[model samples]
Target: MTPRTPDAVTVFGPDFPFAYDDWLTAPEGVGSIPPEHHGAEVAIVGGGLSGLVAAHELLRLGLKPVVYEGARLGGRLRSEHFGGPDGPVAEMGGMRFPISSSTFFHYVRTLGLATAPFPNPLTPASRSTVVDLEGETFYATSLDDLPDLFREVADAWDGALDRILHLGGLQAAIRRRDTGALKAIWDALVPLWDDRSFYDFVATSEEFQALSFRHREVFGQVGFGTGGWDSDFANSMLEILRVVVTNCDSDQHLIRGGADQVPRGLWSRRVDDAAHWPEGTSVESLNGGSPRGSVTGIHRVRDSAGTATDRIAVTDESGETREYPAVLATCQSWLLTTQIACDEELFSQKMWMALDRTRYMQSSKTFVMVDRPFWNDVDPATGRHVMSMTLTDRLTRGTYLFEEGPEDPAVICLTYSWMSDALKMLPHPAERRMELALEALSHIYPGLDIRSHIVGDPITVSWEDDVHFLGAFKGALPGHYRYNHRMYSHFVQQAMPPEERGLFIAGDDVSFTPAWAEGAVQTSLNSVWGIMAHFGGSSPATNPGPGDLFDELGPIRLPD
Candidate 1:
């Protein structure tokens, strides 16, 4: 069948709309610093994808980046190998990435990582899908095989989106990089949706209202693109709109081996085009092959005259202090108040309110490695594969199967759930979680013995339980547009006071599209621009950065 849209959709901001992919791939490169500041040190507090991206780019711009990671290098891009380093991995976080994430794919291409289509429900990659809602099980190779109710729900959603939100027009604007048209559509949506929940949008829309309440329930369980968005029903409708219009959930892919390789590759990859650094220089070699300890405090330094300066002091967990001319904090937003002792004067009260008000949604995943891809075996009675990518309203919610090869051990993500579902598994151990997932799946695939094919230990993760990362990722609540605007626009510091100038932030939490790696990459580029301008550097006129066009193309501001 032919695709709906011929042009590929990109995350070209319904918010900032800056073309980061173009800036990174420009002939002149991002920007350059003065020779005097070639070797100036910049502190990056977090070794996640965002921090690593900033560090990698900063090195190319002829600056030294000192990265401090409390736990591991790849924060949420964690991949847990089952048997050994070369064995199959269970991607605990960020398993699937959409094709619209151009900025992120830039790094993936540069790093030479191989990728394949992820097995989302109803996708060709999964081959077949089994959707078991309430107690009924249906097997299908595509959406056509599903019942009329499923199609009705899908059609209702599309109708509601196009009618209420102008989905197609906004997406066309994003695809063509028409900033004015995109903003005209999205800016109007900011106030309209910022104060409303996603559930409210669906419940109140004329399309779903025409159908029975059961349609809404089915819509939540078997959502569009990915499975079951009921977990995000409480999120702002603007957030949901951004995901839909930008195609953040469609045409997704997974990095072969593991997603963590992206960040780790950036850390160790040599920068051939780096300015002042030598041929073999990398973020790893710059920091002596490893990141520093956790940061405990951050303060703006005062000179002999007792006046605040651009120099910022960073204190590690060992109580060792180092001063830098600029500091880019890419950690979770709550860390500033909870984990780190940041000075009150570093951020304005309004900025502080934005940071403090940021809400994070919980997420949990349980994975088990099996001896082989037994699920591919045929069931003569049912004339279907023993198992298919399963989506159910049961406790498991969504179960994904990953097959490396027929002979190789296969990895099964038993349960990938969020919000209330994730919270339910938080208190349970990995063994108990696996047991609960297997029991739930048994209801869908009765008479199938899943435990017999187990190869090794099961892997489980509750992101909120981790101290270093307070929560999985930010979920913008109702009336959060103002807060999101504050954080997203914080990169442009020319108008800010000197004391709050050098301390910048970058991460998915600080971006409009949180919980996506594209957001992390884009925000990191923004901070790179902010840090560049901090040291008297500028992007080439041909390839002006986000900050250069902030006055005209930045996110629209709402009244106080």
Candidate 2:
């Protein structure tokens, strides 16, 4: 049997701001009714940011849409904490909010949440050290120094950075769907294809290769070879450039309280109301058919009990089956493919064969709560005193420590990038990730009396082992564009008119974001707009594809 409780998603509630109203709730006064959702104006599945945002917009339009979330409402945006008074808060997932978030800013402002730019504490005096398995080291005076040295070395090398710039310009043109510009970028970057994998590009690229020699073990932590310190490496450059041009505004911030403060509140509304939904009942199946389930609701489905059910058929977690007209699947493509068996071969072909090509990236989140901010003056990890530093070390490419509380400071999380690494490190496939963090810290701070100041044990999670999510976040890895384009394309049958069909799927994974809160919200906006338009209602949606989403949130080029 699969474990019912997930690691981070298990903890979600009023503490966060998720605009969704829960369904599995049994709080005070909220009466229960048998499961019966035969006919509703509209039913949205998956109560993450997308589902909630769409429901909110629908409500505003005077349309009462019923949302059916099988799992925790906030989905991945939920929170998990342990210990007690005087103990540390360990975040099982998610990270700090960057002020440059455009879509995030729109909703945050709606909830009256203030914003601050992401701070850079790595200073000249910071302890920015790059250590290797063999014990060689290079120290930087400040965080800026790392990038500067990288820039100098990179400049002395080949013209890869220049090629990347040209590619960025080309991408800008492509976003406009301008054939001319797209061709230009393609032409400029396509030539470098001779270098084989992005790993090869970095290996041959200048000082980039020196990192492996200098900090072999620490290198993997921050990402080395193709995924490491060489931000200018072909694939890595593409990844960074995409975010740069998109959120070019530059404001990075954290919520006033913590990360979950936003997504959780949104999920609470419905759960608190409880009066609107039936008790102990959830959406069994929705198939598109007539005026009701006409949008192919619940194509081919399975009960919570793991029995393979039909889409046009419905079955409870127990043993029950009913037919419907349409089905809206908000799960990931993999889940949708594995669970919902569709009659239409086209949707199946695009989803199973097309979207499944690319691999999911592995990731780990680590949070350390120290007795005091010993590293605040000079970050022992980065050699520089920057508030945060991206360790080019192979061990963990990303690292950030914060002294939020002066008395007993609780350093926030520093998540490192991974590629299918979570599976090798996690508990099990489809299992909740409670990562093996001791390995990384032991390698870096092997002898530091961590037991002395360490308030409680650190919390870590690896997403690679998660079968449901496959991996934590999906990235446009080497040759990803070719694979990515298919994911957001054909799987969704846009051919069906929204009102008559009533069959659609929406989630963070539907679009290029494949992950991230921004992708989640935009998916809601996009799907809802299409659905509304199909139903003769119109809604304006602002989604920043490749152009630059942060523009909507305002310029982030300032320091908070």
Candidate 3:
């Protein structure tokens, strides 16, 4: 792999599109503290899944964790509102959960959050010519359907599908050193699986033949090697497939308002005297001595309405100083590393050097509410039987039409993944996403007329680059989990000398589980346990701490 350029700056596109230099300031500041705020024990950063989980877990274990969030709770699990000038409810982020998420399932039960089964596409927009030229879009519905979907796309594609269909006895081959079966019909697959750009993989695969002009987007949109091969972040196309393919029995689910309901339910049931908003906002003041140059106090950051009042700030509204023995960070790992000052370094030189391993990008979202359920034929281009796929010729692949509002059942969303589509989207600085969504939807449902079936205009969300670390609710890049296997190393660094365990990690970012409520709970449990262990206690096996996060291991296959 070629070396990727280092980028510490991200220009927010729709939300806060300014360069880092504009708003970013060193965590270090030469300021004095107020006289009121003081503290002890652990401080948790971010109110997102990871942060809240860690805080609640610590609280469950009889530990007092002072939680600091730049924004209100329910991080990315937020609800996007529309309608009536006060914003009617709609989903802007993660809309549903899959059945394969067992951990998440148990957590949902524990929280007692009401759920409805995930919905399938009522309309089709996927281009069969792109995904697979085989049969119909439902070909993806079952493994046996592969031949149908693979027939005309490409010999290479068909051969790959045949190889997949021949999964018999391969379980035994997994343990074995070699298997000729993989190469029998899949000679072209290994190369593509290992390194083909999503775009090239689709173009060259039998799937592309499945597409038609009506919907060439569904398949073409998902695969892209855009910024050059080096630009790809992690290798997880096959893994993503695993989630879908292996999840045959696992149906999906959606909450009423937003995904945030899961976390809110958890908080409402557990945690004592949880100091959440709705009453007051802003952390007025702080009263603490600087550990080093880092300010260990209540943060007085702004809230929902962009106001600094009423919202809970780390300190009093006026700015006060406080202290904690340790702090658990829950947002993106980079946020805690850069935004907050932790006098000590939790990672070694080697780990620090590899910090360049990850990169993030902007993905825009739009939710449109309609008067009636608008349906369309599946796109022949991508070969999928879903109405959510865009039938437009524009760049930036649109989203898969998964489900609709179970209650209202009249709203829909379109996700434009800029990084995935073989082409980048138009550079319309202002209404880019909204315009795209409206235009694309109109291509298929010209009758509903967005202005008519649409109960409300589109609500846009351009938050990928916000400091709140708003958009990364999905899984982390591939190697973050494998390479940083030893979460114990984090505790080790804290245990070592000057820095101590002042900085704690929280959030779904740290998990064998991907981005979901379950992963957040596990991350929180393990992180809290790490703190408890320091104070003298052990963690549950199911929820291992840093010890598990960074555990080193021996190689499986040696020099062959």
Top of the candidates by lDDT:
1
TM-score of each: 0.98, 0.64, 0.61
Compare candidates 2 and 3 on TM-score and give the better one. 2
Q: Predictions ranked by lDDT, top down? A: 1, 2, 3
- Residue-level lDDT of model 3, residues 1-560, one tens digit each, is 11111321111110101111111121321111121211234666665666655554454444555645566667777776655433335655555665434445555665666666544322121222212222222333323344532233324333443354333322222223122432332233323343333334444445444465322333332221111121232434332322222232134567655677665554444334322222212121110211112222433334577653322223322355554445566666555345554323344444443333434445556666655444444446654443433323333234443334333435555544534432233244435665665665554544434455556456655555566663454433543433333331344344454333445454554443344454565456556546665555543454333343333211111111
**Sorted on TM-score, highest at the top, how do the candidates line up?**
1, 2, 3
User: Model 2 over residues 1-560: C-alpha lDDT tens digits?
Assistant: 11112221211110111212121111321121222321334556555566666655444333445555555555566555535533444545454444333455556765566544433323321234342323433344443445444444434233443443453454355344343444444434433442245445545554455544433223223332122433323343344443433332133455544456555544333321333443322222111111122122244444799654423443333343444433345556555445444445325443455456645556666665667765455546645532334353434445555545557655645435455343344543211221333345445555544445656556676755444455565555555544444444322234533232445556656654445566666556545544444344432133222112222321111111
- Please report how far candidate 2 places residue 550 from its true position, in Å: 20
- Model 2, TM vs. native: 0.64
Question: How large is the C-alpha RMSD of every model relative to the true structure?
Answer: 1.9, 11.9, 13.5
